[model samples]
Target: EYVTPGGYELEKILNRGSVAYTHVNEVWPNVYIGDETAKDKYNLKKLGITHILNAAEGTWNNVDTGAGYYTGMDIVYYGVVAEDITTFDLSQYFFSAAQFIEATLSNPQSKTNKTFN
Candidate 1:
């Protein structure tokens, strides 16, 4: 069984982690988490971006470019149509998205980014 940590324990654990205020961050080699600007075609081309996982799809607080936007660009695209909200449960996309990210980062020449809206 797992001992569930709660209240101040959880807060303490969470507080130990750090986050930055940057629009784009390279968390691992060839792997990136980027905002709209980073996902721009020109920027992506400059960055040599090989794959893009769009976290914000549709029109509501989203990019709405869809996969077709990257056609003929040698960039692979995957989209998760989601709203950026506190109540929007995104757990459903976690596994598949992770798989996609894993596949994207597996190549030596890969420059993968997950676009944030």
Candidate 2:
């Protein structure tokens, strides 16, 4: 049996874990979670990432890399100027993010494209 922890308990449990973040992580098939640096063209090409959804954008988080940054690359770019704070209502952007991921992974040509980030 599994019991869901309360907010405070869940927070404590999350804080207890300290896993280092990598440049990119493929948590699901053809879907990736990564930092700002992963937006590099060479790296995207290496990772075969045809689309990128910048969850945290603008100069707020020091990530000013917009669509212009990927000028020469044949990659689709989406951005959400999100603030990394508890008070920020990130849930508002959940649907948009999911849509972007679905579009990216659903590409008929994505499966054969294999690369790294």
Candidate 3:
């Protein structure tokens, strides 16, 4: 799920076999996800975004090239962070919808190590 500042929430639901799954997530006020390359960075920066959180995963060599390029232009690059939340398990955790939403909204630091140039 992705949400913009205007209260527009976009959700992608997946149905697999006997399971239906939806990820509850939200974006910060003006952060953006770029393409597999860096095309979306320009448009996002033009829209006045000062920080970018990338949820993609890989080696630093793979992730930081784009992050470094964007940071060079003065954007605050936050991720290339980890994708898993180890605290919650989808099959066994019986959290209320509100509780689940609250948990998701909490910003936890990534377990992945970040490298700097």
Candidate 4:
């Protein structure tokens, strides 16, 4: 049998760092995780972002950019309509999102491959 921990336990586990993150952080050599501020076209261009995996597709308080947002820029986009509620059951998208991130980083034609921090 398996057990899942929720509420504070989960939050605590997810909160891995004390330092405040900026608009975008290069989590890996060619991968990034960011907040809503990263949705800006200028920012994405400045970072040389080749692919985007938006976990919050239609949320108001979160990111709002969709596949159509990058009309002119050369970017690969993927989005999941994740809910901002406790009962949203986001586990279903974990695998697909991971796959997107992996593919984005593994892509040989990726624009850049350097992490600032």
TM-score of candidate 4 versus the correct structure, residues matched by position: 0.72
lDDT of 4: 0.67
Model 4, stretches more than 4 Å misplaced? 1-20, 59-61, 109-117
lDDT of each: 0.80, 0.67, 0.38, 0.67
lDDT of 1 by residue, 37-85 (tens): 4347888888889898888887786577778888889988888999999
Give the candidate number with the greatest lDDT: 1
Candidate 3 Cα outliers beyond 4 Å, as residue runs:
1-38, 59-66, 83-117
Write the residue-wise lDDT of candidate 4 on 1-117 in tens digits: 335666887678568665466777654566667775446788878878888777677746357777798888888888778777779887898898777767775775564322111
Q: Between candidates 1 and 2, name the one with more favorable TM-score.
A: 1
- Error of model 2, residue 77, in angstroms: 0.6
Top TM-score prediction, candidate number: 1
Error of 2 at 12 (Å): 18
Tell me how far the alpha carbon of residue 43 in candidate 1 is from the true structure, in angstroms, after superposition.
1.0
TM-score of each: 0.76, 0.71, 0.34, 0.72
Per-model RMSD to reference: 6.1, 6.7, 11.3, 8.0
Residue 107, candidate 4: C-alpha displacement in angstroms: 1.8
User: In model 2, which runs have C-alpha deviations exceeding 4 angstroms?
Assistant: 1-21, 111-117
Lowest-sum lDDT 10-residue window in model 1? 18-27
For residues 1-117, write the lDDT of model 2, one tens digit per residue. 345568998688569875456767665566667774445567778878777777677676655677787787877788788777789887898898777777777775551121121
lDDT of 3 by residue, 49-70 (tens): 4544444433533344446667
